[model samples]
Target: MSSYSNDNTTMETTTTREDRLGYNNNTLKIVVGAFITSVAWICLLFTLIVFFAIFKSGQLKKDTINMLATLYCWTTAIYEDSYT
Candidate 1:
């Protein structure tokens, strides 16, 4: 019985070490993927909100250069989103 208990303890310790070293775990990958996806979504939402706010303020219409720049930025943002 003592030998069995020792074997169980050793197995638990090895598993704990592997987990600490970030080996053999899909859980970490899933967590990192979730975090990155949430951040990307937040960035996309923020960009859209800012774009609408600028549009509503009439800044895009008043300045031709600014309008062009805004459009360029928005295009690049969309491109980046698709790329990611």
Candidate 2:
């Protein structure tokens, strides 16, 4: 009976260790995912701001290519924001 009790205790200890390791792995994944998402958002915002500056400068007001590029940038920003 004493041997059986010792075996049970050992099993419980092993299970606890496995659970703790799993929790740590999950936390690491969450942190990495958040970091990637933040970087993506920052890039998107930067692109939007750059294009906005160009659009507002009025130097390219009569340029068709500049207008198209500005429109594309705004559309992309709106589309990406919608998914979030």
Candidate 3:
């Protein structure tokens, strides 16, 4: 809890000595992890869409495309393995 007091000269802010509830290190870590995961998923989806468009347009080199696909597979595999 907090309160603000004012006098003719200045204003003072005060809070309770008790600790705040419902938030801690684990909560912070979970929130950060969720945010990162969401951003990563969005980026991954965007990249895939762009890749598909480029593939269809036949502008990408076959070797580089294959390497990218392989890297994506490895990344997915690692993420799944780590999470599960």
Candidate 4:
């Protein structure tokens, strides 16, 4: 029989306290990356929706376009018009 000694315990880079909840450094990185990618996709979808909505409406006036642009910037996390 082989003898095991806990005194010589070597630390595992992966087996950490954070890994208990699957939120280690690597896990956090992956989650953040996925979130950023999803956000980008959502932003693209919103852009396409707004574009189609604005162009498809032949009755869109100057005021309507301005309103749409303002709303788009706001919803897209852009700064207020006063800051621009």
Among these predictions, the greatest TM-score belongs to 3
Model 2 lDDT-worst window of ten: 1-10
User: In candidate 3, which residue ranges exceed 4 Å CA deviation?
Assistant: 1-20, 70-84
Tally clashing residue pairs in candidate 2.
Answer: 0
Candidate 4: the clashing residue pairs are none
lDDT (C-alpha, whole model) for all candidates? 0.62, 0.61, 0.65, 0.62
Q: Top lDDT: which candidate number? A: 3
Candidate 2 structure quality by residue, lDDT tens digits, 1-84: 112356456322234565756675667767766766676566667767766687688655657456656766765665555445
TM-score list, all predictions: 0.47, 0.48, 0.52, 0.46
lDDT of 1 by residue, 1-84 (tens): 123356456422234566668776777766776666666577667667776887788876657557546765765565455434
* Residue 43 alpha-carbon offset, candidate 1, angstroms: 0.1
Q: lDDT (0-100) at residue 63 of candidate 4?
A: 84
Q: Could you tell me which residue pairs clash in candidate 2?
A: none
Instruction: Candidate 4: list runs displaced more than 4 Å.
Output: 1-23, 59-84
Stretches of candidate 2 exceeding 4 Å from the true structure: 1-23, 59-84
* Candidate 3 per-residue lDDT over residues 1-84, each given as its tens digit: 345556655555544433345455677667766766666576567668878888898889987688668767765654454343
The residue-by-residue lDDT of candidate 4 on 11-79, one tens digit each, is 444355665665656766666666765665576577668777878977678887787677666545532
Ordered from best to worst TM-score, the candidate numbers read 3, 2, 1, 4
